[model samples]
Target: MERTARIDTAPADAPLPDGLPDLAHLLDGMPGQSRRQDPQARVAPPAAAAEAAPAAQDRLRPVRPWRLLPTRLLPTPRATPFTFAYAVVLAVTSLVATYADPAVVQALQQGSSTDVAHLVRHPVLVLVGSALWIAGGVLSPYTLGFLLVLTALERRVGGLRAAGVFLCGHVLATLATEVPVGVAVATGQLPDTSLHRLDYGISFGVAAGVGALAGLLTPWLRWPLLAWVALIVGQDLLSSYDPLTSWGHAIALTIGIATWPRLRRAVSRTRH
Candidate 1:
């Protein structure tokens, strides 16, 4: 027994860890050749690397069920007619005013005392001339185009309803335009020679009417139209600065937007 113990102790420097499993030997071995390797062996993923991946990506990548909607559920186009008619009427009236008699033109252009006196004396002629102008102006290229556009729009929204909307918008615009002119005239800030027949008109107001119609008819387009109206009015106020030209459209648009709900209700009631 003493000789056997002596041999074991003497073999400490020799290779004596061949068959038995040892924790130090296993740890010192390369990972691939380690004795602990098995079918169930797994290395934990690095904590920083695992946390770096996006968790929400899986949820975000899934397709939505409603994305396959059809295109036919949309409103008819409104701009096609509205723009055409307004331009035509505005142009023809401008042309007729230019080519006619100087006195009549002056009477139309400047609402001065002298011009007023001249028109009063030629009331019949003025009325006849205005009538002809309206006829020609309405049929002229500019007015005709607008009429074509408005006519189509009217077809979509019944004539009476369209008229009401247009008229309401016009009234709002007219007030914006007329009130300023009235104030200017009263204050004598503008020269008597500068005022014209079209000064009190509501072109922008009509635009608001058209915008409102487009907005209400096409639900998705409503906010955009409102934004457009706001921008246009704001620019007009800031730049060209005509209260009526700049702010009239805004007022008309507001009225038109308000009227949209009522108009829709009325149309619904009528349909029933």
Candidate 2:
């Protein structure tokens, strides 16, 4: 005969039978119960999430238009020290050229000219001195171009590089144009007086700076600038008022264009 099975009931907090977990222990190990009982049991957010929170907050902050005006008009020393210092020197030289006696100004310009004669006698002195004066003094359009182009370039690639670009165009273009004249003079094809022709100015350097800066600009801006420069230089060439200098401007601009690949790499590295 089969007998009915008998079972014993246990309380909610009672100990378990042999080899089994206690009722209270099983309940306490559940996710919700464990989190409630143990404050340190909470799962932490990911490292990426923690980092993104501040950036999100920053994006929501408002910017003031008025606060940017001063920065746009006058950049900090750290941002454009080379441009500031160079502009100051040019301004002072412009003033001297304007206010000084004609005889003194003529002497200074003659001494500073990067002509074949001065270059032969003191290549270093004249190469540097020639750049100190603007051909048309303070009001020259080249002066404005110099300030704008150089400031923009220096802000991107830095002061040393900007100076190098300017000097590269200045010295190389000067040599390229003047060397031929010197050779012609020596070979008797041109007059000996050609060696002493006045050629002091910052025009070539400004031209090169414009070209280099154009490479760094957006396509819309860059093409217009290049076309404008070409138009101006082309007109000068057609007019033939100073063919040698105009050709130098064209050469210097080409030199700056040749530097585009390197300048792009430099700008990329700076951004990273």
Candidate 3:
């Protein structure tokens, strides 16, 4: 019995551990060794792994449900006829202002002043002209912003109403900003030089149009627009670089928000 026990049991520190199976030896000893898998079967990849990989990828990728994008955001513009005309004027004025000789610049810019004298002396001329004027400087960004915003505006309130918002922003902002200077000039508070300061751009009207159009958007779109516009206005104010420009923007923003009541009615009527 003692001799049999010694033959059956091996020492603990010897080559093979007591309980562990001899897997490598079993594989080598098996028949049809070419077909028998040493690695594939022993360390097979999980069945779930192959299936889960693609599903995991699908879960990670986002899918958009709504198909119609532009048609809804931008239906046909409000004043199709006038919008193009407005664009043409901007293009022409931009060309002439940027490229024309001194004489041409003077001729094109003649009525485009928002100066105190121009507003007071020939309010209609300056107001209307200034709205149409572009410095013909900084073409791409301004033009793109112009096209997107003006087209969106026209789409919302019709051409005529959009025009009204624009004119209101332009004329009102001009008056609001310049009137103080005019008063200061009269009271000898500021030199007449300040009154004649050259201010030429379509930014006031554009800002107003942008504001009014924003009123027409759903909350999702509207909130982002408001945030961006606020950021811009706030930055300009903080910089203290351009008071007149900043004041005009604030007035334009206010005017745009104020038009919400009337514009909402118009939007409701159109929808119905």
Candidate 4:
């Protein structure tokens, strides 16, 4: 008959499977063959303790920097109340100009010089009128209420960039409309004069500015804006070639596309 007895060397303080001998008790007992440590047994580290090292390393590592800083700086961050007020004033003046002496307005609409020029002969009024036109016609009404838009954009991208965007779009639209119409009329394919006295006061004003904004903000929209301008110009050329109806918008768009970069720089400088 043979007998096998094993002694577990567990600590008294440790939770045991049944009551077992502590390390102190085991050390005091016989170092028996049945109590010998197994060679295959591994002293495994605690899972939570093992996981903590990587977590601490991750916390110490540097994070990636943001790449979109330039784009974020494109617009000014603050709102400007003055710009909105300016837009409203321009809108009111534009309506007044249209309503006051509808006959005189007819000439302005025709894009020609006649009695209206005689009436607006005063240099100050002319200056004022021109300013008004820039605000009401060229910027606000014509450019899709971009005068107001420019303010918001300026607060984000800055005023100079906003102004550049407005100017470029307006000027480009104007050129696109004017150039082909003038050529067609000169060639005698179209009438000598049609709606001569009028000008495209607003026409593609807002649309052109929007197009410029699209160009600046989203590159993909640039092609569509350009196509729209081309189509409008082509239609104007095909038709009577009137400046008011088409040429002005063409001109505005041309200027906008060409001068946008310069305007942006100018705005940046001004802010600085």
Candidate 5:
């Protein structure tokens, strides 16, 4: 009889022979096969993918230095309403000071001056008027400081609070300095002319804004700013060019510092 070849096949569930490799294991190592089996390899949800797209685009975009300069130098009406409106008023007054007749300018300044005489006669009017005209017009350092500092302060604490801080400094410092002059005049210690001296500007308010803004800044920036202000005011005090005004600046700065505790709490509440 002829010998026939014998054939055997393993069942589907049967284990492979010892010398053979697993076909299933080989298939699982493939890119497509592995992705199907792995949960993390699945595509992200639509919402997540949408969220990531903008961030990726932002990362790839190049920065333009020219575009950033104007934003830094100027205040926007929506973001800093108080500063923008006040700046417009200041600009108008500055133009008036520059173009108006010398006699007219002098008369306006005299009327606006928060001197003891004006304060006593029309406390409300002079106090409000004095702040309208910058002493050295729009080109003054204080005007620039008022723009930058008040804008920054308003951004942090809001327009109303910023206005309050400015007014507090302006009104209080004026009263603090002029009240003493008034007492001296009444006591016969100073000449009557001292009561009517030309004293009108935003310097006191700006000084206070600097002090208040310092409190909100990081310690590194805060201390240096305070030092610089102190140095400038100190030098002015030493020079004795306008001792009363310098003293008023110092007092206004102190008032701003005094508001730090309250300001911090308000800021914390707003954040929460």
Candidate 6:
């Protein structure tokens, strides 16, 4: 009997188990083996999807505050004491005008020959009663815009200065436009019948208020407002319809713009 020494026959990379012989089984258990994909398993998205991912994220992201409800975009940001009172006056006057006898309302609005004659004589009180009076039944939009602009100004500057600006614009605009019409009637540029036109409305005051508010606004805002106002006035001028009202609005807006510097200073001092 002769003793036989055993010799090993295996690859250098893998040691064979004493009983191992199948390479196929070993290949199946390797880390790199490709298994049939489970239909539910997440796979990398296609190129198109990857490209759209950022857009989806942007849509999901919360909106920035500046892009949301900004204060600058809002009018009458909050109820102001002066604003409330002013609104009340407008509302009350509007109601009175709405329900009043048509004849009486017309008489009050158009300034009868007697009223105009008297107002012209005084000149001082011409804007007194008419400032709050809306010739056309009290409109909600008029009230709303008036309230917003007036409130914003009252909130920024004290009521006194706001009042001053309002009066300056209202009284000045009234005297400037109406007096001309009166003078025109006197001068014969317009018929004496024109003096009796229904000229009463908050439009003058509202225009002034809007002008003053624009003055307080940031430069970006101020320009747009002025342009918008200019557009309305320009349109009226070009169309050759009611040029007087447009001129009045322009004059009032100018007064408001001029008062801007002082209004700003007052607002600054208020902060201190």
lDDT of 2 by residue, 1-272 (tens): 99997554544345457896434444532344421233344555798778876886676567988997655544357788987888888889999989999999999999999999999899999999999999988899987788778888898898988998999999999999999998999899999999999999999998888889899999999999999999999999999999999999999999888788989999999899
Cα lDDT of model 6 by residue, 1-272, tens digit? 99997654444345446895645544433454443443566766798778877876776677778874434333332535565676677678778677889888666665522134656665555467677675455665556667667767887886778778888887787668776677778877878777565555667677788888897889999889889887987887788777777787788878888887888888889889
TM-score of each: 0.46, 0.75, 0.69, 0.43, 0.80, 0.66
> How well does candidate 2 match the true structure in TM-score terms?
0.75
RMSD of 5: 13.2
Instruction: Evaluate all candidate structures by whole-model CA lDDT and list the values in order.
Output: 0.51, 0.86, 0.75, 0.50, 0.88, 0.69
Candidate 2 off by > 4 Å: 1-70, 73-76
lDDT of 5 by residue, 142-193 (tens): 9889988998898889898889899999999999999999999999999999
Per-residue CA lDDT of candidate 3, range 1-272, in tens?
A: 45543233544234556896655444432444323233435543698678766876676566664654444343343335456678877877777777779786775566568888888788888777876666446474556666777777777778888778878988898899999888988999999798777787777777887788888899999989988987898888889898888889888888988899999999899999
Clashing pairs in model 2? none
* Clashing residue pairs in candidate 1 (N, C-alpha, C atoms within 3 angstroms): 81-149, 84-145, 84-146, 85-145, 85-146, 85-147, 88-142, 88-143, 89-143
Model 4: how far residue 70 lies from native, Å: 25
Model 3 TM-score, 2 decimals: 0.69
List residue ranges in candidate 3 displaced over 4 A: 1-79, 136-140
Tell me the lDDT of candidate 6: 0.69
Which window of 10 residues has the lowest lDDT sum in candidate 5? 28-37
> Alpha-carbon error at 36 in model 2, in Å?
23
Which stretches in model 1 have alpha-carbon errors above 4 Å?
1-95, 98-103, 109-149, 180-202
Which stretches in model 6 have alpha-carbon errors above 4 Å? 1-79, 111-118, 122-125
lDDT of 4 by residue, 19-119 (tens): 65434434322344233344565655899658776876676666655654433332223354434555666667577665679777654433322112322
Better of 1 and 2 by TM-score: 2
What is candidate 3's local distance difference test score? 0.75
